[model samples]
Target: MKAFRLEELEAQRAANQGAYLQFLRERNMSVGLYALDAGQADPQQPHGQDEVYFVVSGRASVTVGDETETVARGSVVYVPAGVVHRFHHITEDLKVLVVFSPPES
Candidate 1:
């Protein structure tokens, strides 16, 4: 069995960005805690794999194609493969938990 603490993961680097913390990864899945500074925009594009985003704190304006959703703490977003999505307008220091399936290569 393996256990992880969010505080520990906060010290690691994932994409050279300042707003994301990857807490765990195993098999083809991963869990990441994200910290979005105010005015930050989460990059968007098509992915070969599907992913889920769960809001842990603050608010986010998420866009998936022509549709947009306002997410807050305790909210969740599910993104399918090949869909274009992004998180934006991080008014507060947004914290999000993301899970990826069939991990990217």
Candidate 2:
């Protein structure tokens, strides 16, 4: 079994000066943490693998293709491969747990 501590990971993230901190990876799946401050832009593009985002904290809205929806703590979202999506108009800092299937290449 593997255990990961959020605070520890966050500290590592800060030390690395990166926006994403991947904690686990396997053949079929991978997990990472993505942090964005309020009013910051999400610098991401459409991925080739399916993705699931779980909002650990904060407030924002995500636009998947043409549809947009509000998200906050406890919000779960799914996006299929090759779909354009991004979080915008962040009213609060966001910490999102991201899961990628087929282990994003």
Candidate 3:
């Protein structure tokens, strides 16, 4: 079995601008770790695949479509494919575990 440590992943360079470390890619799914500094803007846009974000640490306001919610450690957020989503107003450094179904190409 393959395993990963979030601390190690966090130390790697971010592939998606704001420190995104893609650690796994299976036949049906992909997983990654994303980190954003407290005052940094989230440059993400609509994704092509369905996704789930598990908040690993920190706090922020996540916007999915027209709805917005505050999320913290242990919180989970879901986003449908091709929908508008982003995180803003971060109160602390944010660490998120990201999963994409059908694997992101």
Candidate 4:
């Protein structure tokens, strides 16, 4: 089995210097790390594949479609494909795990 370390992914993300850093890609799904600084804006647009987000740390509010909700560590959210979604009003540095089914195109 393949093993992944968070510290390693964090290092990779720092090197990439991107809001999202993809770590794994398979035919069925893709996994990535998403980070947003406090008071930062998420610039992502709607995706074609269904997605799942798991908050790894910090606090923020996510708007999915027309609904918005607060999220923090241990929070999990599901967003259907073609839905508008983004995180805003970040009260603290946000770290999230993102999964895209059928892999992201």
- Clashing residue pairs in candidate 4 are none
What tens digits encode model 4's per-residue C-alpha lDDT throughout 49-102? 999999999999999999999999999999999999999999999999999997
User: Which consecutive 10 residues in model 4 have the weakest lDDT in total?
Assistant: 1-10
Evaluated against the true structure, the overall lDDT of model 2 is: 0.94
Model 3 scores worst on lDDT over the 10 consecutive residues at 10-19
31-105: candidate 2 lDDT, tens digit per residue: 999999999999999999999999999999999999999999999999999999999999999999999998878
Can you write out model 3's per-residue Cα lDDT over 18-101, one digit (the tens) per residue?
468778999999998888899889999898999999999999999999999999999999999999999999999999999999
lDDT of every model, 2 decimals: 0.77, 0.94, 0.91, 0.95
Model 1, 11-89: lDDT tens per residue? 5644556666666777888777777777976765777778898887888799877799999988988999889888888
Which candidate leads the pack in lDDT? 4
Q: Report clash pairs, candidate 1.
A: none
Report the lDDT of model 1 for residue 90. 78
Error of 2 at 67 (Å): 0.7
For lDDT, candidate 2 versus 3, the one ahead is 2
Over 4 Å off, model 4: none
Ranking by TM-score: 4, 2, 3, 1
Candidate 3 is scored at a TM of 0.93
Q: Number of clashing residue pairs in every model?
A: 0, 0, 2, 0
